[model samples]
Target chain A: MTAQPDQNTAKARTFISVDAMGGDQGPAAVVAGCLISAKANDEIAFILHGPEATLSPLVSKHPILAERTTIRDAVGIVTMEDKPSQVVRTGKDTSMWSAIESVRSGEASVAVSCGNTGALMALSMIRLRKLPGVNRPAIAVLYPSSNAQGFNVMLDVGADIRADADDLLRYALMGASYARNGLNVDTPRIGLLNVGTEEHKGRTELKEAYDLIRKQEQKAGFEFVGFVEGGDISGSKADVIVTDGFTGNIAIKTGEGTASLIGRRLKEAFKYSLLSQLASLLAYTSLMRLQKKIDPRRVNGGVFLGLNGTVVKSHGSADATGVSAAIKLAAQLVENGFNDKLAARVAAILPTEESPQE
Target chain B: MTAQPDQNTAKARTFISVDAMGGDQGPAAVVAGCLISAKANDEIAFILHGPEATLSPLVSKHPILAERTTIRDAVGIVTMEDKPSQVVRTGKDTSMWSAIESVRSGEASVAVSCGNTGALMALSMIRLRKLPGVNRPAIAVLYPSSNAQGFNVMLDVGADIRADADDLLRYALMGASYARNGLNVDTPRIGLLNVGTEEHKGRTELKEAYDLIRKQEQKAGFEFVGFVEGGDISGSKADVIVTDGFTGNIAIKTGEGTASLIGRRLKEAFKYSLLSQLASLLAYTSLMRLQKKIDPRRVNGGVFLGLNGTVVKSHGSADATGVSAAIKLAAQLVENGFNDKLAARVAAILPTEESPQE
Candidate 1:
């Protein structure tokens, strides 16, 4: 039986479409993450996509999740090895596709998935499509920083390998919006990533992007701090760093590798001798605090910007905590109306042309 | 009058040209570093460039340094703020220029400087010129890694923003040579930096470079590991990582920034509470060992390759230890005949073309 929808109750509820397979631990981790998220936020609901037989049992393990979830049968799974192009052509029955379709059909406010990044992005682009005036969609990520909010927004982290001056300008606009709504920073300071802070440095395209982004200071509602170097990514220099996908992708990976290297060295140092072992025990509390502060799982989402619907990509190897963190981020973005506001902002700034087909 | 050179003794001696001014701490650190190297190695000597009045007193501070150093008068100091273009026009009197001229005129085997990067590279290109068959020169730096040798070599860290297939091939050749001689890596494994390891990933130029580099495995005397991502830079997977200057520059800077951030956070954790403060005291020895292992000063020089003469760029803010490390690297390269060997390797692999003037 259908009942009349209560406007206040309906507005308060937020539905998240989730791909319940393809993560490192399969559907179990995804369901566990959803349970954690649902317990934390009572208003959150999910439309889980995967093989109904496998996902339903996992959902029933948590009574609360079983009450707040709806399972959709999707037998096909997009594995990490699947090519993005191939996925686009024949991935309609996969959980990733079904999850994205829910967002496109307005059945869910946002989509979150722990799957093949390339395939997920490809399916997202093809299904949700780009917003009007959007040249190319970008992947905006949160980098640990010494800022008040403890994070900085960096964009184009492997969504595309190339970006012209105009694309960079669009990144600045969308990245600033994300920093404002997601990171809760007002008038976010945006910087163009380059080899040096000097205006004469870097590629010619960077110089042109600098000029374009500078002109949009008033309209885009961001403080253009000119060009910033790589150190600014972790330093308290800027709230948003814009770069082409190639450099950003490499830079982010390099940062992760360095962190891992140092972390391994630190552990070795702590285990060097009995005295050091005792010291580590005494310092356990503070060490745990430091570890929690830098845990990658706490910041697991890479939001796909410049698209009509919001899509959050969780790390492929993410555990339950990481998946929950991603869902939390997606919920925050949905509540803030990030996609609609970003689309409106882009439309207002750039000259309207025929929107490109996916 | 100069005495007749004793063939064996003269061949054993290696002269390093040092720019003793415009560093963060000026001539004192340079003189101190030279003293350390002079005492540590009897065959090393220096051509110290700076105002004699300023450098003579510092050289006298260490009696060993005074005996091994030859002071040259260069009144003009190329400050860090000097523009590269401006320096090219009228910087002949600067210490940086004089130091490089020593190598150019065959008075010194190699040049080492802690001055502005752009100006130093500009002067080096103008004075040393590119080796025949070389498209563009690259800056190769030793990064701390988990390898048994404790380092990996990465190139084009900020030399030029672009690298074609040929340029990348040259980087692989040059980088492998440095890894063998500088890091003592035998038959070094070279990896091309990309966003992913897949053949289909990265830009069009990278795929072309992959194919070109693959053909040079036997000729260059190195193993090609196809494509590697940013994580491989610090991992033990490769001895040499090569990429265009733009990505390499950002990657290196991001790595440094991440290390700094983690180092700071660790120190904060150690000082968080009274119990942790006590633990810090107990772990001082192991902590110091860890610090010494990852110290930037131990690997201080960035060797400029693809040029006729060797030029080493020390960090602008290098201390005495850092300067000594750079000098040690230059001595090793000179002993290995790195420049001559690199030139021969390039000629053997590619058709010789008319060299381009800077």
Candidate 2:
């Protein structure tokens, strides 16, 4: 558990710690994703965690991954049904745990897992711990949007169901930092999500968070857009949308489900008649362009913020495309030194009881 | 206000109370909507509430509404910015108040408003009052879905920001009843909205509500599909999705935003190239069909559940089409005696302190 020598030197290849056992597609998909990442970016390497006997063959199958990937032995697996508390106590021997340990031990720049979200977060908190001023860590996802950047950063999408006013303020700060470092948005506009955009609407905590976020806007290096409605999540109103995990999780899932439904209906629309079928054939490329613009797999990773090290939780049901996209995101974050910047940003404006602002 | 004699006999026309002010498009849009509804249904009549000088001319312009509509003068208006508490105290002279009074006086089968949601709900609760056993009233909206009925009923969508275990249980009961009476589902399936579908997932209150809703499933005559995620709101997994107002409101708005974004992207895709434009022209009918299916205006009303009388809150910025859709829903609910049936269904399954269920 001691810190390993920092293999990720300034000019050296970036190493990503990946859990290859827990994904729905198994080690093969993980290895395939790793090979895809290695082929696409020569600077990326992976420390694959799982049963060596199971993963070694998969890694060997991909000649491209042979030199770029290392298989680490782990005996256990954290099932989807495993409680986070139970995993924290007994999951030390699991691939998910080992993957996070690599980042904690400084052997890898970031960690990626397509396992149980709660367990991965629990393990990340216990292993790497939280940043100095952070009371609770959050999971930030890049939601497809109509903004110029094509996506918006929304957090805490299921790390914890409840977040008080201070936790919300911290999410705004962390989310803004992620947008700047990860999404490349300078002076990111931070919006506190509520039922309505009116200052008088929404819960008491939201109003309190509004004032707190506004006060720290200048020091935190972000713009406060006052309060935003749920519809503004995908609109161009803000680059970073912050809310408690309970509402954030529901909003993100609801958005995904709605998009999926529309996609299905669009397909159905094209098959209704012979003329429509011919039209679909003529507009195939255009339809593909639209589909690519809103595809959920293109933005698959949910970055866990406030932790000492970066951890990206891929969807449990993600395929190779999703896993590859997550790895690409992890590499991008590592290259940008997202963790260090986020830590500094949060610590700089963190409110204190003795401070005059309070 | 005294109760007017019931003109709505078994064979008589159904009278609808309309708030002719407070909409974004003003009273013109309200009168246009009334004309649309009057022309569509011969068995419907309206009591329009607004300033006499303003509404009389608008109603007179529509020959179809001349005999079907009655104008009631009210001096004041409820601007969207007015606080719900303030409206409750000084809103007696407003059109929104007068419209609710029509329902309270038994002159109208239902009340319809395209005004401030909080003000409408506050006024509805104060004038119409909650049902005998209902503690907090909830607003239920029909969400576009993949179900056979083409939509699912989701409740507590911005009625109030909070709902405890007991209140959530009531929402489940009322939502199920709505699916049966309003949507005409034989035996509606109810699902508790949670971050995850697992038994171990979500808040403590959700778990408690889960057990309570389960106990009444058989007696309440609805199937309890335990612990549905936000994705299920638009999926075919359940017919009724229940959650607290804060989460529900955000989820619905998020869905609308996502759908609207996709629609905009689709339009942009059609305009990307000459070939795509030709394809769009060729597939106009099919695309129109798809547009009509997912159009927000088609399912525009948010029905206030747990109230003694039926009150439908149309979107504040709803156009004539949206307003007409709301009126259609109100007329359908009145024809089916939805409020009385809802009350009876709730009272029948309501658990009492002395009851064995408690």
Candidate 3:
């Protein structure tokens, strides 16, 4: 697609604010994505915040963008190489902090960033705070499927590494909301990713987490399925999969690596001999299709859920296409009012004043 | 592939013992696999071990099988469903135990099983004992790759969970030795799998392990490469990647899941409509080629390296083809004297006086 400059999508109630200098691709891709969103649907407003020196030139090219897109400049906060511990002290002046704070202040409905993940998370927790009834936040990502248009959502990809049973339940609830709002799946099937599918598998924490998920209060509108193995991440057995960030990150990266390996190896094999080249040529179209299915850039990135507002964490190594995808996802989340619905759902599950801690 | 009778196989130096009751496919697939191996490679032997009541009649159709095959009737053993703690107590008279003993007693060169991994691991650790200069035994397997005829080789798939710095170094040495003798890769480059390739990145275990690998007592006939990501598993960047079993297991399972997913998705995408189906039909030969390239079953299983004698573990759910591959790998490991080479190599790396401590 063509990414053009635009001030406003359609006259919609929701607005998605994106970090102007986030991600490895810089602001051009995000700007292009905003332009693309305007060309397609006009129901969302694009809020871009970052260094004006780098973003304004890209925005000025598209004459139609003057009214459709608005920009805010931040002094600057975090970089991909910044230390996670440093985000807390230095985020006051960073673009990521400014972008997130915009959502918290209600100037924008949601915020997205492809900057330092740890910094984004740290700033989000400090600025957005937890949704009233939630504990820690979760990062939910959608892995695109080629045969199917819908995506499988993995929660807590890199946010909450060491999670307990209750944390897992909250992750599931958030993931379900993500699946429903992002993909529009009706009653998304949620599964807890574990070492085994058997009831008695996984470590003690996972076992306890399994029971916690089964509690009536935790299984909200979505179908809380049983255990899922690493295999389920690729297949369409579940729309939403909940796991600690450590395993989820590894799973996502492993899938990405394997797909890339497939693509690269096939290319290398094609160069080996004439017969192989002929075979590779024959399979070219199919390989291209499969690549699209596994392409990290096309799938965009994941959204860090459970924050007071919106904050999308794109991989630092992601390319222009990936940045564009993140921009689109941020818009979708904002237009869908994901946070409000998520907060409402979470409040219903959390123990209230009447049901004080046991 | 036709499986020769046990006697026929025994006549050749390439004798391989198989546990008939192991794996999800059970006896039928194991029997079929034995026949296939015996028939395909005349130099290979199939020392079938299981209940005589179950095996004798299966090969009775070919009267010539009497001279070729022999059955060692085992009354009982550990089932895959059994817990690891009870494997030894309950599997006293089992086929799995008997098969491993065959290798120890020189009755067979290698014992291959596709049974409960936990049980197999516990039994092997106790029965085989660690080789000289080896701290802990590791289970290493070959992954199907696009670079060579097969996939990349990796170690510590699931044998030990909590690997220390020294254990990783030992695994690297064993994997390097296996690559040199078994895969015939001279001066094989070994890599440590971590979250990032940078020296300071990843969990503390990884960072410590990386330093030891990069600056440890150098081993002969091996190149110590730096850290690699999950992508390298398929990229052929390094032949052997050393890590704790937990992460390795996750990576392998995730890779398998993704490869299957990519294949399924491409098929669906190709068949989405009349137009796509036309493209798919045109690319059928290519699709077949891709499937063959990424088939996990073809890799079959991995060897429990660092054991006193050779032992190979097949996937619990392997089919006849998978079992056949495992049998071949075990036989090859014996023929190559893989353990002997690894023992000699590792012995030279450490002090002889500390051998007892190791």
User: How far is A24's C-alpha from truth in model 1 (Å)?
Assistant: 1.9
TM-score of 3: 0.86
lDDT by residue (B11-48, candidate 2, tens digit) is 47888999999999999998899889989998888898
Candidate 2 stretches with Cα past 4 Å from truth are A1-11, A350-353, B1-11
Clashes of each: 0, 0, 35
Per-residue alpha-carbon lDDT of candidate 3 for residues A1-358, written as tens digits (9 for 90 to 100): 1222232333443566778775676777767766775565666555677877777788888755545566777767477778766877866777787788778888777776778887788888887888876777888888754215457998887786567777888888898889888888868888888756778866677888787667733347777778987777876778888888766777777788787777665566456556555645555676577677667777677788887787777767666567667767877887777888888888777764237443
Query: Where is model 1 more than 4 Å wrong at Cα?
Result: A1-11, A352-358, B1-12, B352-358
Residue A78 displacement (Å), model 3: 4.8
- Candidate 3 Cα outliers beyond 4 Å, as residue runs: A1-13, A74-79, A86-94, A132-135, A144-149, A216-219, A265-294, A315-321, A345-358, B1-12, B60-68, B75-80, B132-136, B145-150, B272-285, B344-358
Better DockQ candidate (1, 2): 2
Is 1 or 3 the stronger prediction by DockQ? Answer: 1
Give the Cα lDDT of each candidate: 0.89, 0.90, 0.74
* Candidate 2 structure quality by residue, lDDT tens digits, A147-185: 999999999999999999889999999999899988899
lDDT, candidate 3, B1-358, per-residue tens: 1444333443555767788887787777887777777676666665677888888777665444434565778868567678877877777788888788777777777888888888888888888788877777888988765445355678887787568887888888889877776677877888888766667666777778776676543545667778877777776678888888867777787788887776666666666566556645654555466666667676677888887888888888888788888887777777788888888877776773345232
* Native-referenced DockQ of model 3: 0.35
Alpha carbon deviation, residue A287, candidate 2 (Å): 1.2
**How many residue-pair clashes does candidate 2 contain?**
0
Number of colliding residue pairs in model 3: 35
